[model samples]
Target: MYAALTSLHWVYLLFIILIIGVMVLRRDTTLVCIIGIFLLGLIATSSLTTALTGVFSSLIYAITQLLGTILVISIIVSLSHIMTHTGINEVMISPFTRLIKTPNHAFWIIGLLMMVVSFFFWPSPAIALLGVVLLPVALRVGLPALGAAIAMNLFGHGIALSGDYVIQGAPKLTADAAGIPVDQVIQASIPLVIVMGLVTTITAFIFMKRDMKRGILTVTSTDLQHFDEQMNQRKAPLSKGLRLFFAVLIPILLILDVVGMIIFHLQGGDATALIGGTIIFILMAISLTAYKNKGLEKITDYLINGFQFGFKVFGPVIPIAAFFYMGDAGFIDVFGKTLPAHSQGIVNDLGNALAHIAPVNTEVATATLTVVGVITGLDGSGFSGISLAGSIAHLFSATLGEGIATLTALGQLAGIWVGGGTLVPWALIPAAAICNVDAFELARRNLIPVIFGLIVTTIVAMFLV
Candidate 1:
């Protein structure tokens, strides 16, 4: 009876349904499932008395647990917004535009930089920064906004997220679930991730090259005006000295942060803090240097815009993250103590059920992991479904003989790389919104390259792993 009833975490299953319904039929509002989770979890506790107490308690619990991750994301996003409005971000991008002279260069560079930044910071925030700065230049060099956007989505969200080297998020969780060193998973995934990256990059470029020639293609000014308006404000320009200051200082500071992260060994949220603090200082320096008399007010007002930008980009995802987080053992420890110690949480139960039905052979496990990833990605947010997948991987790693972590990472890659935003209209909306492209069209454009990449990655994983 326990095995039968627990096969589906009723509340979590409800959250999934809630998310799908909201995305397909409802639309507009952010995180309807979170509210549903509160109500549903409350009612599951039994009586009206338990429902009343559990609802508020669960809400608080979810918020408290997710706060650190959320706050770091919010601050980084805020810093990115601050830099953009202040023109410091523009000054920063001015240098990159000088280098990427061709469409191929633009595609690879945008994809590469987004991967590097997003490895440290999550992709959603990083995409806004990359899109605002490098995206236009990519377009100017004859790359379609669709191509640039696709690059951002794939590298930033896919390869970077699967490895999660700096943040070590997916790796750490998988390692913990499998009871292995985080470093072990990291080491194992290096070659597999690189193979996937190469295959995906080549495929995406091939798809994008259909429109642009080897040299350059021209687009109408109206079709591409959004890129220019990125740093344009109706406000006044800066003085020569102030412009010179940002020109000289910003790169030095960013370089210092990069060097420090390497030397001091920053990981997880610490890396985000390092980048966020540096950006704030950069924001301050520019505000003061540009507007000496009004520096304080400008700084304060500018930061508000930054917060808005951060929230606008990531706000919807927080509730979604919160909802999915409930599927993890981390959050369950606190609110779910009512269950017996011997009882399993959502992740374990699902994994145990899977492992029991299907023995953990190499071929079976690899395919299972990849299929799980694809399924998880259906609701979008490739990262959302990973913790659950990680948990399942943990259960099977012991029984599956060799290469469980590799299978796990591959599974995670499929789910997020596709669902997170690369090929999904709902997930791609943010990138599409600022890039001024239609999300559905972008999804259609991305489908072929992305699918080809996935097939290649899956095949490679089977042989190699």
Candidate 2:
């Protein structure tokens, strides 16, 4: 049952506004988030001691909610490192190089492969897996390094990560915040993801081709030298035969995980566990084989590398996540049942209040969420703001009386497409570095296409909502 709004609810709304304002200015929200959490605890419990402890407690709760995602990502990155060092990744990706005979061939092939691989692992690791092996082939075929970076950024970071169908990390955060099922958000994202991916990538390809014709885009000697240097750095300790065997074996094992997910109907944490388990074993086996007696030491080294990456990526996210989690089920988890009886969480209570005072239409709700998502993404973490989007989507959806999953998916797409790596200069570094292109240039080339795609996708989401 719904209850009337209280100071707790208004305080949450005020902090949400402040967080959005900070994000729009492209500033860090961690301090703002910590203060918000402390204030929320203060208001709910009226105890300075409880409020102080609540900050740490909320972070623990957020981490508990997010640990599965962090672990799976860490494991995948660890496995990627081992595969790269042993030359298994190159062997796996080398066959795709045969498909690139021309510039057009290179763009689509590299993009499609990146998207598919990114779906299972992650865009960052997928970039490493495909970049070194394919960059030379793409360059030989006349595709500019900037063009390759755009393709990878749009396809892998933009498309695969926005949908995140297999990994479900993005959806899990949004869905939990929205008080909806993860599968519902994933299903709702399919059509929007397709539209956004097609429009953005095709528009980018056209612009790239036009630039080439105008002599504005060309393969550079510097890019080739960079690629050569990276290639030279990779000397696999494993024999050619061993590399080939593992390369073939790895894909089959990854495919089996997909098949297992479908057969067992696993989703969310279970699906991630399935993949994480497989990758851990893969890392151990490869480390043992590649290092012989030194295998045990190498496995720890790879995992440490992975955990470092995982924590680095997630560090900025935890505080914001902790603050937003309080809007939903996390409130009671962090601070006891401090609300009045019948309160349906802070976000829902605010939504119910807004519904009674001023009815919200679908168009306004859709546009508001798109703006909020884009603004939140401006902070450059893509993920740092999605939980906020989910909370706001839930609030608005409650007023509309429907379409929570669609709104959540739309917000997820907008935030990730903007900050996940495509439009953000800093976020684009990995693909830009790998392709030997300037990150700012890649972001510039991506701007028009991504904006057009977001506009189209927003309109499509309005209809779906």
Candidate 3:
């Protein structure tokens, strides 16, 4: 039984390596991941029908797991789209342009603003809120669009989403999978999150400065120019009074939402639901006030557009996520009664095997968990592999004793940093699209800082653990 389980674990690892290989080659891994699910099911259950059904079942499971994130993103996007029509979106950020008189200023302001906003509203909505309004300012101030993209991607996706301190989505997932309290995961992640954020953001800023000194900090693309022109094409039909009212009112409302979270101690889904509820109300108010009698029609249009964007972004991720989800013990219900009764999950089994086969020490455990987190992130959905990370962290903790939270936090950080948006092209789309730069190029730019941050963070994690 042990040998068979270990062999199955090796198969899972083999598929993970293959997925990463394809991603490194700049190829899509959706098909490869689907095949992996089928093969794993076939080997585990010894039934072709089970394997085939598992493919569909896994996809459904992945979608179900991701639906909340998808809905929140869609609603936020819809809100952003509505605000754009009223020109309030532009009004909302125009004040920041004054501070961005230089490339360095633009980088810091954009990056910092994105981080804060993403922490509250998530990167997807935050990108939609800031991209059109800030990209032009950053460009005019001598920051290359690519640099601006890097700033947003690094700060928002890498920092805010990785730690997920405010909303606690990442920690919730990791903690739940690890069978630990969410607060424990969040507490353990704080220092590592700061370290990772500071190291990566500072490194990126340095790179941007160097690029600027070399006279390479220019956006020469006509596409960017076109995008800017299109953004500016919509005029603020509202009076200055109205625009100013909303500009101040909107921030206050969002800030209040943050305050509510803090006062009520809401975390994870509750916090997200709060933000989502606020955005919906904001969307309704904007549609009704701006579009008048046409408000209903306009709101529907925005929602449809938002859902379209949301699903489009999520489409390629589903199959890839499905494969990784199977490696988590939490999804056994999703896969029905097919899984072996004693199976702890492929990733958990791997961790157990590694613990027994090797000298289980802090460094080895830390490295293995980090690597597993990184591997799970290959699907380009950082949250998908976190449960696996949590499960494996639990297994390793049992062997090593103590520091489960620290190891789990480390795995969470690694998974999110790689797969969240910085290192993956598909995941970087919101930031890239907003900045009017190539997602692949943005990923390339973020690679060095993120990897270095991960290494430094892992070392720090060893000490903490």
The candidate scoring highest on TM-score is 2
Per residue, candidate 2 scores C-alpha lDDT tens digits across 79-108 of 988888889989999888998999999999
RMSD of each: 4.9, 1.0, 4.0
lDDT of 3 by residue, 1-465 (tens): 442364567777788778767754556777888898888877777789988988888888877766766777788778766766677867778878899998889889999999987876678778877888888777776788889889998899888988887656678767766767788998899999999999999998898788878887676667467667978686766666776787788779878988998899876677778877887888777787777898889788888998997787667667766776777653465445444446666665666666677768999889987887787677687765666677678778866768899999999999989988989788888888877788998898899999899899999999998
Which 10-residue window of candidate 1 scores lowest in summed lDDT? 1-10
- Model 1, 1-465: lDDT tens per residue? 234434236555555555554544425324564465555455445455654454456546545544445545555555565555555555655677788998788888888888887865577767776787787677778777777877887788778877777656566545544445566677777877787778777877776676566534345686567667754642435754665567667667767877887899775457656766776777677677767899889788766765665455444544554445555553454345344344465545555555667766666666766766666676666554554455456556645545766766776677777777777689887778767777898788778766777777777777656
Pick the winner on lDDT between candidates 2 and 3: 2
| Model 2 / residue 387 / CA error / Å | 0.2
Give Cα distance to truth, residue 99, candidate 3, Å. 2.7
TM-score of each: 0.76, 0.98, 0.82
lDDT of 2: 0.92
Q: Pull out the clashing pairs in model 1.
A: 382-416
Tell me the deviation in Å of residue 119 in model 1.
4.1
Question: Which of candidates 1 and 2 is the stronger one according to lDDT?
Answer: 2
